[model samples]
Target: MNEQGEDTGIVLTEAQKRARRSRSIAIAVSLVALVVLFYVMTLVKGPMMLVRPL
Candidate 1:
């Protein structure tokens, strides 16, 4: 493996970087929304959600 001036990967263009960042933020927002939804559902369901008939 030659270490001198080794090209690890192609440099991303400004447009590509912006697009990648936008996608990342969108995904993060989606995941956060899902988590909030589940939390809200748990609150709305109350303790009865944990109680099951044996």
Candidate 2:
């Protein structure tokens, strides 16, 4: 038993584990994409991006 009173909290079922893993992977991918976007925005000169008022 854990301090929180959940004896099998760490023993997730296979399906649960797979779901969690996929969620984690998606989050990591999104973070990486955001970082790359930020880097490109900062590194690329203004002329490379087209801007128009909506």
Candidate 3:
């Protein structure tokens, strides 16, 4: 019984590690996308667009 419990714990840890890695990758991709979006917006609207306000 104890060995089975240990095996289960190990499996759970591995699964958790994969989930964490996936989440990190997703966050990184999102940040990159956000940066690209901002860059494009700046190019289309001009650099001073933010300073002028609505």
Candidate 4:
């Protein structure tokens, strides 16, 4: 038995699932924001600049 009195392989609880979903949504939003920022920067200049070396 695990700490919750069940097997260690137990699936996530409702709250845990919700938390995971929220995290995923947050990640998606952050990615979208980054993409928008990149697009805006590229539009402001002649072309996208390399912020870091490849």
Number of the predicted model whose TM-score against the real structure is largest: 1
> Per-residue CA lDDT of candidate 4, range 1-54, in tens?
877888777679999999999999999999999999988888876444656557
lDDT of 2 at 8: 65
**lDDT (CA) for every model shown?**
0.90, 0.85, 0.83, 0.86
Tens digit of lDDT per residue, candidate 3, span 1-54? 265565343344788889999999999999999999998989998957678766
Residue 11 alpha-carbon offset, candidate 2, angstroms: 2.3
Q: In candidate 2, residue 12 scores what lDDT? A: 86
lDDT of model 1 at position 29: 100
Q: Which scores greater on lDDT, model 2 or model 4?
A: 4
Tens digit of per-residue lDDT, candidate 2, span 1-54: 777887764678899999999999999999999999988886784655566557
Which 10 successive residues of model 2 have the least lDDT summed?
A: 45-54
Please list the residue runs of candidate 1 whose C-alpha ends up more than 4 Å from where it truly belongs after superposition: 1-4, 50-54
* Predicted model with the maximum lDDT: 1
TM-score of each: 0.74, 0.64, 0.66, 0.68
Kindly provide the TM-score of model 1 when superposed on the true structure, using C-alpha atoms: 0.74
**Steric collisions counted per model:** 0, 0, 0, 0
Pairs in clash, predicted candidate 3: none
Error of 3 at 31 (Å): 0.4
> What is candidate 2's TM-score against the reference?
0.64
Could you arrange the candidates by TM-score from highest to lowest? 1, 4, 3, 2
